[model samples]
Target: MSEHGGDRARAEAWLGQDPDPETRAELRALLDDPAALADRFGAKLEFGTAGLRGELGAGPNRMNRVTVMRAAAGLASVLTSRDDLRESSGGVSVVIGYDARHKSDVFAEDSAAVLTGAGVTVHLMPRPLPTPVLAYAVRHLGCAAGIMVTASHNPPRDNGYKVYWEDGAQIIPPLDQEISTAIDAVGRVDELPRGTDWRVLDEAVVEAYLRSLARLPLGTARDLTAAYTPLHGVGGAVLAQAFAWCGFPEPDVVAEQAAPDPDFPTVAFPNPEEPGAMDLALALGKGRDLVIANDPDADRCAVAAGGRMLTGDEVGGLLAEYVLRHTDGSDRLVATTIVSSSLLRAIAAEHGVRYAETLTGFKWIMKAGTDRDRLVYGYEEALGYSVGGDDGVPVHDKDGIGTALMVAAMAASAKESGGTLLDLLDDQARRYGLHATAQLSVRVEDLSVIADAMARLRESPPGELAGRTVTEVDDLAEGLDGLPPADVVRLRLSDGGRVIVRPSGTEPKLKCYLEVVVPVTSSPEEARTRATGDLTALREAVADALGL
Candidate 1:
């Protein structure tokens, strides 16, 4: 008997139901290779709050036609079982969208078919669109659910299936587990009923989403010269149209990445946070007032100004200040994640607006406040922002296109005042102290390395870091500060420096978020210098303690 004897049976079963000929051939080849067969069939991709994401391949463990089909059917089963949802919505319907990744359109089509076959009405996007558009469509079309086929900033050969509930935010908690259970119960892809009678949406859906952007409270100063890049993804055309519609000058887009290219040839990784990912865009931004880059699906926004890429926390602070000043709402709320800098909370306090800190990701950011308090603005340290319109949150997810418009508007207003974004940062420092932030990430080949490091810390935590006394240690897995339980640990120094360590939800990396707040007693520049030094020392101490 072979070591992969069980996997052989699973692989053969998967091969029989896989709809894609490419994947079927790959699986047939893997059958004779025991190692590859076991890898493909050892375990399935676990679906959770974020939905399914993995390398594109031919087995249950990888993201492929069969995997997507099972996920879609599972979601459909859950939606159909919701009698209350059907009664409230008149019927269960879903809006489906996809990006330009490999087989994204096919996956979208298959999802629509599966859902429709399961007696759920499907309104599918006419073409590949940004993930935010789908999020907005879920609410605009009054859908019970939404699905987007995109891996966001992942590498070329990766793809994903992201689920959004009727509230237009990513699914969370019990719902995710319920859908996962349904997926596990799914027997075979070929046996799952599929239909092609779903409705294909028109340009009206896209136009409606754009109209919501126009409602953003942008000032009249639209004289900003900007450079933009979509990082060889699907955001370029829509972002251009959004800028023009909002009365801003058309930005100088990087020619190499102006069009949607799934291969993402210009950069090693399509994500703007990756090293050298924005090199070309930054080069083009030399003489521009601002530079903007969006991830592949345009769900996250990154900005550069004065030839420097501003950290996500800086952008969040600026945008929070801008929105609070321009918009008029008595019960407005601003929010950030636990890993993000605490600057927004200070800004919120100054403005007397409600504030919250949630677990990382826009899913938590979007659900920051209660129904009484509207979420006027929310952001995370990972370049994701969800800014509310004049009415309410038009898109209840991270919208890079909407954020680009706001960034342009803010830049124009600042330029008109004869200052740059750097000046605004200095002002923020003087008013609210220098809240400097940095990150330390360790990418691992084996996931257990991360588990081992975490366990080591939990068992024997360092009493001090960087010569500062460890005033408090928060085991986030025990759920601190009214937030849900998470695989995270936070260390707070007596001097007010802080460190948070957690496994990256989207990648194979363990990350540490560092913050050092310094009072601006001297000049803002001097305070920044001191804060930077403290953060560096803190980073080194954390690295030594982790022993990774």
Candidate 2:
């Protein structure tokens, strides 16, 4: 049969099983357009460690009810099959949460129905909430698993499903594979049994999560002025409540972007990392002591201070220092991804704390510290931070609300000392030798473009970057320092700079992480200028090497 004929057959089959009439209409609308049909039904959206994330539409290649129901059934199958977990947990249970995204609530409800039908007790969040709340719920309710419906920083047209195991962290390795295998075995979504036995939880869970924030070692300093925006997400009310509960002043919220709007009309992309996403917040925060922004799910945080938007590495370093200062560092662990700045290692050494560098995801970062050492803090370069305070991680995931509180406390303390976050950053630069970091990300319309770029770099590695000789090349695919094999390439420069090139797992982009460290000889400003220049050169050289 012709490819179009095959797509038609698949589309007809999918339309029959798809329960969402909107998606069914979508499929029918594309029936006459072979190209559109091919786009919708050409390939199934792969369910990997990140779970399912794609544009919202009909067919298996998109994020629709059929795809979500299959994934939920697969998750139910995995939970049911895990006799060890079931026995230990007493019963199979799950907590579901969602953000204010298109079809997010629908997906969450459908998932709950599927899990409930499979004899799994489902405790669903009463309304749209942050991802961290659900992560906290998994452990708070003692459930076997948790599911969150969000695309988290993706475009407005996109949505996603994130799965967390009993550990409250995102799934990794065998579990992701196991769930994927079960999803593949799913025959028909319409045939899957769904139950209305799931329970809609009350504000108790949200209150519990907020109460846990009291444990954050934020010193008694509530005299901090700040501007905040949730980027048209569900974090606004919860974050405001968290601030009140934590004794900090309620932040001056950006009214336009405060409410949960699925279309995210203000920003082109609801991600704070994207350029101009924080423009409104920055404008509102012009004279404030600090500015904070959270993505659509509020799992990741971004900060702005001293008339500048702080890089994720900068925030990670600051938070690491703040956390270590408050905690007994003898047994605690601080970790960051391999793509983050090396400054965390230096800070960890100075603080006498264990530090780990994991592969590029929070999945690996959360699993950094052992049961003995326990993860006190973990962060990645994408504005994701998990701060455990002196105790243990309340939310075993990146928590923007908690991080924002810490930032506020830190800013308040610095203010009391006649300094600002910028001054503290200078102090760190002076002590840690100005560890500057930057990223060169290239978004692509074609997946093959990213693949070709990686292949080109791997085939012909750069001999040097930024006038410095390449001292060492570590093809991360071969595994580095006991890390699992990943599609990444790291190059060490003679001047102690480094670059790591890899494809973004969550988005269609090739990302290159660049860092250049310069010792503060004369002043931190001078060192920063030198390091910035070196980073610019390195960025260009990396772009050239990648043939971008």
Candidate 3:
């Protein structure tokens, strides 16, 4: 069939089932607009490890009622088809959770209706909560599958749905592809059955989760004051309560951003790592001992200490040391993504803790500590941390709330030692040598540009960088370790420096992750100076190699 004709037919057919007047009108206009039609329907949104994320509008490309319902139906179909999943004393069960993004609540309800109508048992969170809460609930409830409605730190106009398997981690490999296949085969939305029998969970889950938070104390003084913000997200209230319940001083919340607003009026980008996104929190934290922030969904944590907003790598290194300081490294593993700084490896080795590097994301990191290994903590450079519970219950995802609690405790301990978090970082630098890292991201008007750049680099493989010979290049297109294959290229340099370039899994950009290490022979400051100089030159060389 002609692609344009198919788009027109699909749009006309969707109008028959679309219940929202706004979306229906939008689709009707697209039927006559060929370019708009093609843009919306030329390709269906592919469901991968990250699930579905896009702008909110009409048509197949946008996030709307029909797309969510179809995703729910597809997920329901997959879970019910698994014979082992159905053998539960009850029927196949799924848990649904959503954050405070626009249309998130409505999408959650639609999922409940579709899953219940598919003859599967469904449990819905009573309120919009953080992604980690949903991820924790999946394992805590012993459900066969889970869905979280959130875009994490994306802009306000966007929303998404992330799928979790029985392990409570995001779906990977054949599962994501399988769910995509199911979604592709879904019939019209009106033909799908909708029901209201699914269970809506009470505060029991939240109460239990808070109680679990109470057990994570590391003998740190609770004397530290933290300035905090939730970036106009739903995490503010829950996080505040969790800290108070844990007997820590009440954080000074950013009044303007304390409440949940779907528009995210306070920040240009809701992500904490973005420039100026933490300006309000930083301003409020000026006189405080620590500044703590969570991305809109509270699944990621960011902190500023001693008038310095620490990079994600620095926070990760501190947290890794904190975890290792408290526990005997026996049978416990600490992990980070391949793109993250190698400082964690130094700390882990110093404490005799096992360390593993996985493909980016907590899904792979979580598995590294599962079974006999038992992961005590894991983090990524994008401000995501998963601090394992000492009681053997695995969170299996990056948890901002839990990590925030630990960050507070870690800061308090540092204060008790008559120093700050900065002092602790210096101690690590002196022991493990200084590892400085930076990222070069090229946001493109066309995604094809990223593809072309990656192809060119692969074909012409640079032999040198920053006056140093390039020792090795691993074209990760084929796969690495036992982890799944990904479209990434990694470069190893002679001076203990490294670089990895890959297309972002979620955003439309090519990201270059660069890191360099220098020995701390003279002083911590000298080590930083040397590493910074080396990194700047490396950045230019890398940019030249990618023709950026």
Q: Is 1 or 3 the stronger prediction by lDDT?
A: 1
Clashing pairs in 3: none
Angstrom error at residue 39, model 1: 1.3
The residue-by-residue lDDT of candidate 1 on 244-315, one tens digit each, is 898999999999998898899999999999999999999999999999999999999999999999999999
Model 2: per-residue Cα lDDT at residue 155: 90
Q: How accurate is candidate 3 locally (lDDT)?
A: 0.88
Worst ten in a row by lDDT for model 1: 386-395
Report lDDT (Cα) of residue 527, candidate 3. Answer: 89
In Å, residue 83's CA in model 3 sits off its true spot by: 0.8
Clash count, one per candidate? 0, 0, 0
Candidate 3 versus truth, CA RMSD in Å, comes to: 1.6
TM-score of 1: 0.97
lDDT score at residue 480, model 1, on the 0-100 scale: 80
Regions of model 2 farther than 4 Å from truth: 444-456
**TM-score for all models, in order of appearance:** 0.97, 0.97, 0.97
Which is the winner by lDDT between candidate 2 and candidate 3?
A: 2
**lDDT, candidate 1, residue 383?**
94
Off by over 4 Å in 3: 1-5, 446-448
